[model samples]
Target: MLTPQWLDALRARITLSAVVGRSVRLQKAGREFRACCPFHDEKSPSFYINDAKGFYHCFGCQAHGDAIRWLTDHQGLAFMDAVKELAAEAGMELPAPDPRAAKSAERRASLSDVTEAAQRWFEDNLSAPIGTNAREYLAKRGISDASARAFGFGFAPDQRQTLKAALPFDEALLAEAGMRIAPEDGGEPYDRFRGRLMLPIHDARGRVIAFGGRTLAKDAGGAKYLNSPDTPLFDKGRTLYNLHRAAPAARKAGRIVVVEGYMDVIALAQAGLAEAVAPMGTALTEHQLELLWRQADCPILCFDGDAAGQRAAMKAIERALPILKPGLSLGIVRLPAGLDPDDLVRERGAAALEALLSRPQPLAEALWEFERDAGPISTPEAKAGLKARLLDHVGTIGHPDIRALYRRELLERFSALAFPPRYARVFGREARRGEQARTSAPAVIDRLQQLAKGGARDGFGLAVLSGLARHPGEISRHEEALIHLARAEPALGPAIDALLALSETLDSPAPSPISGAIGLPALPDRNLYAFLIEGNSPDLVREDLAEAVSLLVEKPALKAAKAAATARFDRDPEGSMAEQGRLRAREMALDERIKRLGRKRAASPRDDSSRSPSPGAMTAQATD
Candidate 1:
């Protein structure tokens, strides 16, 4: 026997991608790995491996499962064989079989028999002459005959001992299976469900584990929908209606539609959307969400357009926040006002329902909209309340990266709402100024002259830094190279650091009030280059600036190579000195290139496209 804890430990120790990749050729696809689904043939890669989530799914064929399931399905290994192989690979020992556990397992297996027997009996009753009202109710609800049979629709007669007398199973087994209600006062035990249109709820393996019933009588006094009690065979929280059927279709469709009830699921299925499921007459549980994620990355939650539906959506959002991962979240579809999925599909047809399903609101944006419209933000106090509520939701997120991103995105939305005019004015002017300055030779000259004056030895370095500070937006393109230069050459570290700092404050390469606040190196002696004068091409200056950064970035690497040569002299003196000479000459050649930068501006063709800095031409970065 293997305990669940030990199985989990074994699974935790195995990397799913490492196991899957042994047989499939995987390519890096963002946070997950993708490959052609080995289970089925396809041209484009639709299969994905997410090691973080520890599963593989094929959007094409709907083949999905964990490592153990993979071995069983793909390789045709038996359950324990797969488990034993995985455990051995994970360096885990199997647990010894326990008599109590075996007995409990046997009891659960026998209870399944009871549920299965009850399911057949109910189906027989629905087909019998006495089940006319249940059949009429199903037809009125637009449930087709095919759907009734496919979903195993049945009827429980309006009598206590109808099932008790029908099935040969003992009363204890019936009570244990939740098919019969045992009396607490030593009275006769009766059927749990009576006079209802019954639908069997299945486990993930498609076993009939429990029943959910809708009363057929017009004046029925109880709840409209009633579910079986928690029993050994079924835990409502862990079971989703139509999961076994929906899981496969969800994979093929690449999305799962979560409706409110099993009837809605059946209706959607009849309308050709077979990938729909529902919770067991309760708010979505964490276990149900996990099951949904196993079939699809982001299951679209389609709630009704009424108030209770919105509340259900909000509750689901709250439930999902703490467990959200990088690629796993929810998509919300708020149907047309005053309509549920079944209503929309029936009134507007399947196409209308499909349109809504096609365009789902992402969870984050939906969260923002839901909270923003929760109340009017007409006053400062009201706006502050909205902000507080949003932050409160954001705080509940567990993943650090996702939490920080949510905070940033939500706050940015908040800032836009609270102070839109100021940002618009500031960014609008910055854009206009940036356009004007890109071609303004005088403005370019003014920016160059702001840096500290330096001699010829420091002229090129100073020019590059000044040009970078002026085009502060491009700092990120060369951020890596700049950081490398800073680390390799300590003497230039302060000026480089200052320019990097300046780039952060300026939103664009425009003359910014904040840009003037950062310290900058003085201009090189103006006589160092004729290109520094007014009327010189700003375009050419930018090109030369990019080239200068590239040249200066190479210097440290050359120095490090020469030092490495020197370090090796004791062992390979001849080769080391020769290598050193080549490196030194390369350094001189680099120096000549630095001197030729200004001349390149003079002799270079005036191609407008070439003048614009290309990505690899300089490793300059963009704005944060």
Candidate 2:
């Protein structure tokens, strides 16, 4: 009862060569491994293992299968046993046995039988005299006879009970397979499709699971394109049409193309672009996107250029952001206006589509452009809205590194857009500011030294300063926050200012004498928090530091909000009290977070100066 996705994951983890090489010695044959066929009697090697495709094949005996198949066929294990062995090897936990799910699987198998029978019957009808109109419709769409046959094109006759009468399956099974629809008032079932050119939708194993039909009659008073309802055998959201065929072609072509419909997939295939697939008449789903990623790192989405298509691409972008990994993403190709893959190939030829596919707009660029041009941005409010929209999209991204990068990049773009730079003037002004900050750093450091020597420091404030000193690179990253911190606690102003000025002057991230100059002890003394302790993970420390700074920034903002609510209490007592309550809850949460961060302090510094300088001493030591 294991799901296809789970089985696919197990196979993806287990290498075919590694499994086959256990039984037969395999030699490196370019990108694949080759060895003598274990399935047949042969002297020369004909068996080949392609780890890239996750399958092995033999030319001698024509025996072919994947890792699970290899275990079953060659190793003499049962199907479930083979899956269990591979799952154990792959460190995957087998799904607990569910009787209901088993029943569902059995039901789907029977429904698949119904769909398969219906497919054959439809194909026969297409070849018969009744299928002449469907054949002519294919011709007009530039679909060849061979391409139609390869795609298993068929037709449902313009009759109500044709499919039910032709197939030997029971009426209930036919209705369950979506080949027939049962009457609501409990009468006999009728054919679900009538007078439509049929294209069978398949599972990943190329088993006919459902059907999509396009009307052949021009004057038919019904929807032009209709897909089968979600049956036990078909979950349209999780299924991509033609993926079974397109996956192998995608590996060879190094890319996969996604179009709008099955017809577009066929047209692309006929145009020599066999590595194309389409969703089941819906926007791309998360499962389908993962299926595409399995074949290619960044499958190009070749959607049409009309408004609906553009919205589809945007929908895909929104869907993809939360699940995107380091290398796994989608590329987008927007076809010319008023043209789809089918029309484009028919009119301009396949090379036109190829040229467009060769250089697809990156997903990021597509997102930016779609949002940027979504509406007018002439006013300040409009521009701010655009920035907010971009940030909203960036915030959905799950990976922390990718989210930060996208935030930085999108905000930088927003800055460039909102306040277009005058490069020479701005550069000169920045250079002067940097030079002034540099010249004044020593004086500021001296002031910090005097203050640090005399004061009974606040422990949290000291930790924050020491944290910045230990990680000077973080100074620039949290510059604005530090400035706000300096404002909120004027006692730490000089030290924070000195760190800010020094951040501009330091050329490298190497430890400096800031800690010593600022009247703190050497590197070992600065381990006030676990984040600053030596041997801590760099990423963890950065995260902890970011949280600490964010809390520090939030403290003053919360205080100000509470003050405003108090001030308004005289005029709007009830509303202001509610606001006050909300702010008080936030203040408590902020305090709890600060306490949690403070609890990350280590026992004490280990007197390990040989390791590196403390935050206070970014460079070599300096005397007061």
Candidate 2 residue lDDT tens string, 295-382: 7889999888799988998999999999999999889898998888899998899999999999998888888999999999999999
Decoy 2 TM-score against native: 0.63
Against the true structure, whose TM-score is highest?
Answer: 2
What is candidate 2's local distance difference test score?
0.78
Clashing pairs in 2: 469-615, 470-615, 511-618, 511-619, 512-618, 512-619, 513-619, 515-616, 515-617, 523-614
What would the per-residue lDDT of candidate 1 be over residues 380-481, giving only the tens digit for each residue?
999989889988999999995587567656875785586432122664553343433333333333443443442324566666765565455555556556
Backbone clashes under 3 angstroms, per model: 16, 10
Q: After superposition, how far is residue 436 of candidate 2 from its true place, in Å?
A: 12
The segments of candidate 2 whose C-alpha lies over 4 angstroms from its true place after superposition are 1-66, 69-102, 186-188, 422-624
